[model samples]
Target: MIKHHEPLETAGPTVGAGAPAAGTAEAAPQDESEHGTLQKLKVMQFNIWLGGSEVEGGRAGIADTVATVEPDVVMLSESSPERVTNLLADLAERGLTYFDNKNPDDRAVLSRYPIIEHTSFPSWSKAVFSFGGTEIAAYSGHLEYRYYVTYLPRGYGGGTPPPLETSEYGWKKIPTGPITDADLIMRLNEASGRTKVTQTVLADAAEERSAGRLTLLAGDFNEPSHQDWDHRTQDLFDHHGTNVTWSTTKAIEDAGFCDSYREINPDPVLTPGFTWPSDNPGADISKLTWAPDADERDRIDFVFYYPDERLRLHDSLLVGPSGSIVRSKRVQEPGKDRFWCPTWTWPTDHKVVLSTFHIATR
Candidate 1:
């Protein structure tokens, strides 16, 4: 659905807000590139929830959603080559012929424009996005998202799990059981994997910038950000054990890449932007009947860009549902003031996030 949600956290300027907080790496470039007139690109970042085949509506739903959104470019995760082909074919029927194949296993980049190869970093694929005569380097990356403790089997947390009411307002803490660390060692190891990938991608994005190119990075990061889980939010999600300085996003920010969603919605407390679990209510977790912890969700998917004088945030939307599926769910708590749930017709278990940018050159 095309929503006209309120402009979130309007305390700062819409574009070129100001300098980064002390110690934070500057995400946007300081200078401008004299090239062309104002142009825009609507990019979508989606994780097709298990290869896009494990959803309620299946492949057709995946294609339909893409057609519905009609984003200029898409960065996908938990995806396969076959799924991308299906989506492209579907869009073609609508006279929207998107061409993209720089996908390896689980991540892919599908674009409406011609994609030129970028060889700076051998690990992740980079493409030249020709936007209104301006060439910007777009990096499509799917970082390692599996963390140890998070993936551990249930019993680790002890007793019954907490009541996690999923909605636009995000996870609401309910009185339940103790937040355990039965698999702390394993979870820590899993988190380290994310850290490794974060460092690698940052270095690559930096290389793209040094070459004098505007850069964009989109993907399923699998980890949360240090900014999102700070003092104001720690007490709310206290069940998480400790507020993690998730290295994947931290490295990206330190490397000077602006999180498109976060840039527009500055307050994590207000706009959590939770994407995982999709909380579809139709998800197939029957196999995990014994593992409630297995269903723990958060905002893991993202669309981030290297702030350029040419690229300015226009708007962003978190595509999903608008109510609670879990009954006896709390309604209006602070920070839980609103909820946007996925429609029963929605296919994937993760919400799709779209960010539009206005690129102008003087």
Candidate 2:
């Protein structure tokens, strides 16, 4: 079986005492044999929401994010070549090495360790590749971020979208109807396509399924639940994903992987740490305008940890809170005001997420 589903909930920030050391970088532990082994892996997955418009310059947001929680290995989504290049440059200044982010269409993996190898699995759509790997192939992205030309719209956020959920109680209550939410249904199917890519890679990794080498398939999967598609035409549209709830957790589980958070928390999903809203809340009045800790709802950013339990998972956490969306103040000085156009907030509608994994050869 796909490892009995362990329903889990979002684990809010760890209060003082049990919290991992903030703003500190410790060397990844080593094994007695002197072979490179991961001591601890704090893998984090986050979607910078189309970029990082919620904050000032997504650069600042990215830097601040890394400095805040400080994960050793991070898998970020929705990034572009420009943004990734900028992030790499900025991260380097801070003594952090961003491995294998020099690509297009976002979906990047910024690691503190050296990347061994990198490859991309071009999809049938010809628009986006389903998989990308590096020399190490340990922390590789086996699944594609999906951009089916036949199904996807001409541009990002284009084409027929899912119906805006209108609930009798509120946005909290996932609308249940005879017809599936149009856009949600489409994204859900797109999700399966991504999973197909993931399974194919995992099947290959099965040969070297030995410990130490970890293949993490993570990032924002714009789909929800492996069950519960009771919406307009959910049976027709939601299709195979109809039975699943509004959760990517279920989708990854379907790919023969385990939810990293669930592996630790055992709740149904990430509650307080919903990354979809960019922590600043979105157009959803009920869910938007995140208030430090009050805004508690659902999470769309999912992390699927392939059955690699050897890399000492410790302090494995999702370090994210809302980021600052500071509107640029009009500073009329020597063309410098708009000279350095904040390359972050103007980029997109999501906040950046940072995570680290401490690898040790124990």
Error of 2 at 85 (Å): 1.5
**Evaluated with TM-score, which candidate comes out highest?**
1
CA lDDT of 137 in candidate 1? 74
TM-score of 2: 0.59
lDDT per prediction? 0.56, 0.41
State the local distance difference test value for candidate 1: 0.56
Each model's TM-score?
Answer: 0.73, 0.59
Which residue pairs collide in model 1, if any? 148-187, 149-187, 168-339, 168-340, 321-340, 321-341, 321-342, 322-340, 322-341, 323-341
Which tens-of-lDDT digit does each residue in 1-362 have in candidate 1?
21221222212122223211111111222334464565556778887776555655656556656665556778877776777777777666645568775565667777777777643232255667665556677766666542323322211321212231111111223234334443442345343466565566677667767877678888776556667756666545332444555566777888788888888778887777666555454554442122343334456678888887777887665666432122223112234212323332556766777787767643
| Superposed model 1: Cα runs more than 4 Å off | 1-35, 118-123, 148-191, 238-241, 281-295, 323-344
